[model samples]
Target: MFFWKIKKNPFDYLQKSFFFSCKPDVPSVNPFKTSKLISSYFKLGKIREAQKLFDEMTDKNVVSWSVVIHGYAINGFHSKSVELFSQMRILGFAPNSYTVVGVLVCARGLPDLVLGKSVHGVTVKSGFESNSVVGTALLGMYAECGNIFDSCKLFEGMKNPSIVSCNAMLAGYIDNELFEEGVLLFNRLRMSGFIPGESTMLTVVQGSVALESRIVAQSIHGLVVKLGLDSDMSVNNSILDLYSCCKDLDAAKKVFDMMECKDVISWTTMMGLLVNLEYAVDALNLFLKMKASKVNHDAVVIMNLVLACTVLGDLRRGRQVHSQAVICGIEYDLPLANSLITMYAKRGELQSSKTIFNQMTQKSLVSWTAIISGCLQNGHPREAMKLFMEVWVSENYSLDSALIVSALTASGVVAAFELCQQLHCYSLKAGFSHYRSVQNSVISAYANSGCMDFAQSVFEEMGCLQDLVSWNAIINGYGMNSQGEAALALYHKMRKSRGDIDRFTYSCILGACSHSGLITDGLMIFNEMVEENEVMPCQEHYGCIVDLLARAGCLSEASGFVDDCFEVMGPNALRALLSGCVLHGNVELAEVVAKKLFEQDPEESGHVVLLSNVYASVGRFQNAETLRTRMDKQRLMKNPGISSLGESSYDFG
Candidate 1:
């Protein structure tokens, strides 16, 4: 019967139709009959049914024992399999090569390596140690049990360690986060002329990603194609993961688009790439596309969708995804709820975020941090501080690094310098004052709270020096205080330092250049960034560049630069360009940019006002009136002009 037709490969699953050909009394037959039927049931993942028949067997042989052992081992019941192995031994049924492999797999979950060593002894006594299948199994068991030393020892002792054994060791090193060791092992495997298969490629990619070695990742990708392993799903997914983790969204997309067969994991990975890249709209569209393709969306995809909606500030989409989360029974899952609240808060919907926060049955530190951070983002610093204090009083919660950072950020908002100092002392006691992110936040908090002296002191005490973000925080702090020359000096020192210059650093430096009207210096830094720094200019950088050029009265140069730097045109760039044209009274250029800005974001009232200001500055009263009339007709209110609000008091407020 067609139902009885089984694929010759042992790895293949039994056909569903084969149930029709199964005899009703098959379980009551002889030992061979029971073993075959049990093996079939085991292969189909009917573990309980297989276990019932095995329990009924009056005279079980080694084959029947091996079958049950393998079923338990493969199904992740490692302890039960090991216990059954002892039972088989008591019954005087010696384990064969396959049974030895099964027993080794079962020994993985054992805490002590003694059981695994005993299994190794059994394999040797059974003369199955020489079998490559059993050898790989033993190697994998040692690796999984964190006995890397023993695993490598086993591989070295083998007359010929197969590619499977090599891949297992490589994967073990990666899982242990010994990236350098994994890379070296992979190199040694290549030198030994044992061709790396897809699994090896995946292991190497995992190592590269963990190390954040983009060059190594790219090389591994090349090796994948060179070795013809790119078609392997595991290899492709690893490549995708590496690119996403590296923040190389373009590279990730290239790998994603190159895949001929995209599984749900692949789709989820692509969605993750979009989220990490901050292409939330595109990510949501891709997720909808995945659903349209009939691919099952897992929890990861759902989380990505929630993130995308949050970014787009599309409360409607967020609510739709929330409904889906309810259907999936994860809506109130603490992490998911925390994420939803964060998204809503970022979109300025503090009410919805607060409601969700209040509804959580169980709250983690993440939940508290999310709601507190949301309050900070939604301009409720007092509310944020209240929540932070509540979290502090609740002894059930632990203050993680993120929680402290958010509290410090809120402290900066309220200019609660004394509270910030207390938090700083707490951070020191917690030993997180030395943590990079925590230290960076401390510096930013001190700088923003007008505690420049404290900020400088913290900056000087950082043992590992400063990262790009630290430098940015200091430079931006200096810029905020109108200390342009000081900011410029810091920028020069940063450029001279051997630190990486991210977009934030470039953006800060440009702000300094704009403030100081350092046209020559700004152009120099911009050129250096594009040429030497190789930090791709995003909208922030482009805005800074345009502002610097415009402040120097080079409106035409700034306009031309904007046209060229049109890859990721954002509101800031348009504002800078329009402001520059208005400052110079370049009516033609202002008209062009304002029209484009209005077209792109008509709801933003600043563009029309900039055009009106340009017209008025150029003595084009008629044009100014015309623009005003247009604004009135469109019900667009001009943004308030820069306030010369006097600091009557030298207080922090």
Candidate 2:
């Protein structure tokens, strides 16, 4: 056991080390070893090492050159690959199909159509154009280069196009947003007796999703199941996306449950779909399940979760998600930050919203719009206007339709006619005046700012391009301006021209009838809305009708209507009828309606104030004083009326 080992010869060890070290310089005539070494270097991703070995080779064959070229192309050295190909040709080495493909791959990576076209000339001169492999490579190169026209032409010229070639062309159409064309091409491919592969079906599914055609998407889904591609995770995810985007949540859920393995995208897609459909509880539950399953989430998932939490007013959950986003290092993600801002703002937490907005390093149009809209909604019109001014002066932000509409709304709220006109001029200069929402907002702003002529002019200019909103805006403008006859005339014109009348249109016309004291016309239109149009009357509609009858001195008819529709007639209708009672000195009716309103909502100071005013008007001083005492005991104060003097406004506080 204690035997000593014998040492090897020093020369033998040195010779073996030398032979292994100089192996890359193997005999030039024996090109196989050099090629193998180059290939091994490439396999290890040592592309430069592979190139150095090839450069040391005294006798380089096409195989040696191809290995280096392919290494360069696959390693993202696209230009170097092309340069090597040129050098190979200059050295009088003929490029085979593999070499041509390597060069074409370089072209595809470069996305250089000019170089790809020149390669096409080389393939033609070399008589490799007819080669199936070369032809497929050329097709993919051209397609990926965004030259679909040439790709299609090359595809047609192929003697027998393979499934790979067809899939390449389909991918090109889909990637270029030519979804309809992609779908049509898939159909044509089927007609040509080519079996569609997973890639082919995936492209078709994408096209259907883009077209938003549920029918077509279902058909493709059926085909996928028939072809047994339902097991493919990518295809399954695509189907999920298709169904989610089409708003077919039931079907999307079915697909998700059937999947044996669910990825993050699957869970995210489901969560996002539920959020969009207003199923906030279900979205949160699904998100919890995803977390339980240990699925990683990206910024998009966090953004959608914030929105869901906002919808549910779950501020605690929102803050938790905010913390998670911060830990994940995506709190600064622009879209997620924007969603956080919107969530906080919607929940009346403007301080938190502004804090998040201030921390954003980069803000998109949607970001600016969200904060500006939040300010406007939170009763901070001045802040909203200030933000708009910042957006206007920033070279980084461009004025969009939403920004313009929000600014116009702020202007209208403050009744700043000069600012509104300036915004209108800017819109015209910025070429956003023709946008439908912007146009609608401009009309409303002009009307609200006491410029009826401008409102009318904007409405007229819209002409046939006017939608239902446009019609509603102009008609409401006329009604609010007390030009009720003009509003009625426009309603008649809208009825004659537009067939798809909405509830807003009817509401506007009914308001005009109430303002103008057109009782008969109002009754006729109300009947048409309920009976002919089949638009169920809401509380606003009922209030308008009651106001119309009451304002016309038809107290009995108004009372009868209120009694007939008492269950559906909300407090607004009761208040309208009560005002009519007060105006016409109908004390019995006033007492009945006031009691009903008090029983409905005792906290509404308007109701108490109206009843007190009625008692005061009739010299019932004791009753009025008693009501005032009750209001003081309840600590309820009525908002004062605002009046306008020449160039100034005052509130009777």
Best TM-score goes to which candidate?
A: 2
Go through the candidates in order and give each one's C-alpha lDDT: 0.83, 0.87
RMSD of each: 13.4, 7.0
Clashing pairs for model 2 are none
Q: For candidate 2, give the lDDT of residue 306.
A: 95
The clash count of every prediction, one per candidate, is 0, 0
- TM-score of every prediction relative to native: 0.62, 0.75
Q: What is the lDDT of candidate 2?
A: 0.87
| Candidate 2 C-alpha error for residue 216, in Å | 1.1
1-653 in candidate 2: lDDT tens per residue? 21221144556665676766677753335788888888888778897788788888888899888888887888888999999999999999998877888999999998899988988998999999999889989988988888889989998887788888888888878888898999989989888887887778777788789888889878889989998999999999999999988999889999999999999889989999999999999998998899899988899889889989998999999999999999999998998999999999998999899998998888899998999989987877767888998989889877888899999998876677888899999889999867999999999999887788999999999877699999999998888777888998999998898788878888898988898888888899999888885588989999999999988889899999999999998999999998887787777788899999999999888878778778888989799899989999999988765444543545675
lDDT of 1 by residue, 1-653 (tens): 43344445423434344555564774455898888998899889999999999998988899999999988888888888888999999988888998888878777755447888898999889888889998888887888888888888888898877777778778878877789999998888788787877667777887888787778878889988998988888789989999888988878889998999889999988888888778998897897788788988777778888888877878888989988998998888876888899888988888999998898899999999999999988777777988999999888987999999999998777677788899999999998966878888888888777777798788878857577778888888777666678888888787687556677778787787787787887788888887874787677888888888887788878888888877677878879988988777788888888888877898877787778898899788998899889878988865332211232112231
lDDT of 1 at 631: 78
Steric clash pairs (candidate 1): none
Q: CA lDDT of 349 in candidate 2?
A: 90
